[model samples]
Target: MANPDFEDLVETFEFLDDWEDRYRHVIDMGKAMPPLEEALKVPATKVDGCASQVWLVPKIADNVFTFRGESDAMIVRGLIAVLSALYNDQPVSDVMKIDAAAELGRLGLNDHLSAQRSNGLRAMVERIRETAAAAA
Candidate 1:
């Protein structure tokens, strides 16, 4: 499952004039994510450090990692979607190469997010990187 969404998002973000519109687009991307089954929602998948409740589930097959995530707040959920595009459906080597912090900066999202949200976002990226490292 190779997701092509990240490049599209980057292109769209480049096209957008302001952060507000980009934020809206990010939210829309989250809204478009399919709802996870109740069975998959569990304590083990939960992502900590977020003001809002968030869950992330990672799966690996044939050396490719994919993720499923959910969050209580719309914005947080969108952030999860953004993370999915950034991290999911990739080889362990590729995932290991990503500097999640710098990549978020490239997206111009770090400056706009609240401090709490920023910490939460960083936590999420750390979790993904850890998962990738384990699988790698």
Candidate 2:
């Protein structure tokens, strides 16, 4: 099941008629995200396989999974926001159960994103899953 926040995003995407409008919406979401502190941008949090610089800092409490992420590219940052909506505040076990590709597919991201961006998104999802799995 998708998070309510993510579902809301999906609804918004459905309302938008064109890819350009959806793209702008995603960029706006990225612009709204709080920037991660420079201190948290260390090698430990840096995600590999991304064309742009990216970092994800996990904050697990009482088995709940949450993370804050940042990226140099606007689209990538938006992607982080989407992932946050999809996975944050969920139980660690539930995080592992999420079908990320299917959820993201609802946004038609795969059809629009460049190959490199798609790979980077997958890398981000993998990193999230790995972090959740370790915590579980």
Candidate 3:
């Protein structure tokens, strides 16, 4: 999908004067994520190092990569939404060039994140990049 959702998220965060509002917005994004099929929720797709269970399935077609993910926790699911905005349906070249931590910093989410959340988020990024590398 051609997700323009990240631009909306950035604009919404800029409009909100407080981290509380941004956090709420993130949670809302999580609420918007499509439900993953139970059949795709296998151990191999699970993201390790996350406090909550996360499953990611990546697909490549016509030189573009797309992802589907889900998380048990709302905030983590929001983070996955952020990833979808950043990574989904992108060319492998674009995906390989991204600095996920830097992009997440643009969202201003990391400083407020708990240590575990931050670590899990980074783990997700690593997984994405690794998948991108293999696809490339």
By TM-score, the best candidate is: 2
Candidate 2 residue pairs that clash: none
Query: All candidates' lDDT scores?
Result: 0.86, 0.95, 0.87
Range of the 10 consecutive residues with the lowest summed lDDT in candidate 3: 1-10
Estimate, for each residue in 1-136, the C-alpha lDDT of model 1 and write its tens digit: 2247787778889999999999998899889888777888898888889899988989999998889998878998899999998888788778878777776777899889999999999888888888888888
| Candidate 3 lDDT score at position 92 | 81
Q: Rank the candidates by lDDT, best first.
A: 2, 3, 1
User: Using alpha carbons, what is the TM-score of model 2?
Assistant: 0.98
Candidate achieving the largest lDDT: 2
TM-score ranking from best candidate downward: 2, 3, 1
- Candidate 3 off by > 4 Å: 1-4
Task: Report how far off residue 103 is in candidate 2 (Å).
Answer: 0.4
- lDDT (tens digit, per residue) of candidate 3 on 1-136: 2246566667778899999988988889899989899999999899999999999998989989889999999999999988998888788868888777777787898789999999999989888899989878
